[model samples]
Target: MSSPDRCPVVHFDHHSPEHAADPVGAYRKLRAEHPVAWTEAHGGYWVLSDYESVFEAARDDYTFSSARTSYGGEGLSVTIPKTPMHLHIPIEIDPPDFRKYRKLVNLITAPAAVERMLDMISHYTTWFIDRVIEAGEADFAEIIGVPSIVTIDWLGLPVEEWSRYSSAHRATLSAVADSPEFRQAVEVDLPYLSKQMWEVIAERRLNPADDVISFLVQQQVDDRPLTDEEVFAIVDLLISGGVGTTASLVGQTLVWLYQNPDVRLRIKDDPGLLDRAIEEFLRYFSPTQALARTVTKDVEFRGCPMRTGDRVLLAWGSANRDEAGGFENPDALDIDRWPNRHTAFGVGLHRCAGSHLGRAMARSLIGQILERMPDYEIDLDGLVPYARQGVNIGFHKIPARFTPGPRRLPRDDRSG
Candidate 1:
């Protein structure tokens, strides 16, 4: 057994182009050799590649703190290298205080609330498909517009500006850190998004409406109503959380389905099969791949020495594919895989609150593609995936061709 001072170390950078290209192969090798290997990348951290370590660390939030209280404090930020942006509430804040903000968020995105929005999700899905039905081609990544529109519309932001927010967010996640695209997203695009959010917040303060923004503006935290900063943090987190996640999953799954016409036909023939297929795809793609946490104290975890203020990354993507995660053929996609408890969404308290909404969005968007564009074919040469796969994985563009079809818009809803 390795002592606290001399645990195994490895060279690993999750955002590296090589890992992005073959993340599964990279993780498989690491997990096989050292499930709890230490790495000196991004100021040094540990990577938990196996299922058990990742799942337990996520559950034990006290030992693995998520709070990013200060730049020079014991508290560590969730993202490696830390972000220049404001702290994301709930996720970045720990329990007790975390639960306070999460309560409000949960109410906003509860399963029932998301169920109520299914019609809207379907409508927007139809609208986007209508745009390209006649042309028989689409940059399929644009389907992200569906979730983008629903999220902003639910937040009571201008529904029409969904494309701007989604585009900026896509660029931000898809680009390499400090690159021109990244700078544009952070300095230029994010500022625009924040400005728009704050504007609506101001409007809701005086003229509160029946929307998430108004609901948040009127809510309390720590015995007082939320401040502008707090409100922005929450709203920003929602947009950041909702915009790219489901869209990425849907985009990747679409590509997979195109390559696996047998599975695609099976899903189209039996609509019920899509739910299980989605679960399998979630495991395979793991759109929200891994998340970072700060070790709270000096301790030996999984036989490795981890000190207070040390950083650790729980590789949810790797965990999903971990052989011991109790799935048959762990590396392959199995729509029929039963009782699949994948950690595509992080486990424990921070397990994505918007999971139901995300699933619903995927069902509407991908289901429509399989139904409307049944014979869609991807332009493999034109496909563009994100350059870096840090915390999220997504495609920049996926050009596709399908037989031309008529717009399926409702007669009275021809506003698109």
Candidate 2:
């Protein structure tokens, strides 16, 4: 033994029950005390906590190389294929290969392109709220899960499949992102995901539409039309990212808002405040947590030596709460927070593709909720906020009670 005081490496078995059952207290020590500590577990990976380190790690891909595709300046972990036919499309390819899929993604997630989906998004937003209003009480996970579920609607697919996909995605995430057990399980479900995406791709190929799937099927990269497997793989990546991250983030947002009424009232008073609040929430909660990368060569992060071929982990979620050079009271919910340089969606060439839309959807919901249910209060006893030890961070359940507020009743006696 090297003795307790000199032990530099801290290993975390994130998949352990303790990780989910209780994390804040478990994580607080690491977040504050060990900002750039290395980990002995998870195949001897490093754990980055401070915002500067995490952001630096995310931005410097050469040092913290991604396992997948890189966007304008961000990247995600590559989904390791257990079997040969497991599939590695947009997300598994790095750099040049990553860029090819990124171009197609940029076109679909563009402001104008997303703008076209606004009406549908808003319609579903209102409808989502109405579902809760009629019930008088609801699990925000199921009711306000529109922005994510409806995103599939944008793909010209049945939103009804959300539950199944959600289940499979969560299972797969747990298997691959959390522990070896989940990885083994993921091997079984991944092929099924490919089949599902193939069905959608085939439908879009026969009848091309303005939808993303259709655009993908008709797209050509490197003078070659993307293979059906490639298209399906990309689709699977997009679907999983949109639904999983958004759902968890939204669910976490609701619970946080309910817990902090002062922040809630600010948005309720000035609905426009959500423009900033949405960003702040993403910064504060940072539901996606950490992502992994491989070290291409020996490098040092802010004086810390990192070796080549090392498995490094970027704790994006915890970084947002670092005491030094990070957020002030990073743990608190501040709707008016600015200069909030939190790396929630990540940084570098793989920054989140649908970040703008995620903010828009969040803003839209905050607007609707404040207007309709200003007096809404979450059931603290029933507030089963999401607690995950792996891939994403968010709510599994957020029970809320919607109470009608004082408002003028519309006069419709003779209205046509």
Q: List the residue pairs that clash in candidate 1.
A: none
Name model 2 segments beyond 4 Å from true.
1-7, 21-27, 68-89, 174-193, 299-308, 404-416
Local accuracy of candidate 1 as per-residue lDDT tens digits, 115-193: 8888988888888888889999889998557899888888898887887887777666557868888888888988987
| CA error at residue 410 for candidate 2, angstroms | 18
Candidate 2 per-residue C-alpha lDDT over 1-416 given as tens digits, one digit per residue, 9 for 90 to 100: 22232235675645456767655555677776676776654445666777777777777766666654231123235321111223445545568677988888888787887787777777777766765575567777776567656677777665766555665565565443445545544565556655766787898899887677888888899999988887777776676677777667677777777777887887788887877888788877776777777777767766667776666667777777775645688667777778787788887788888887777777777777778877777776776544445557665667778874432223231110
Cα lDDT, all candidates: 0.86, 0.67
lDDT of candidate 2 at residue 303, scale 0 to 100: 62
* Candidate 2 structure lDDT: 0.67
Instruction: Quote the RMSD, in angstroms, for model 1.
Output: 2.6
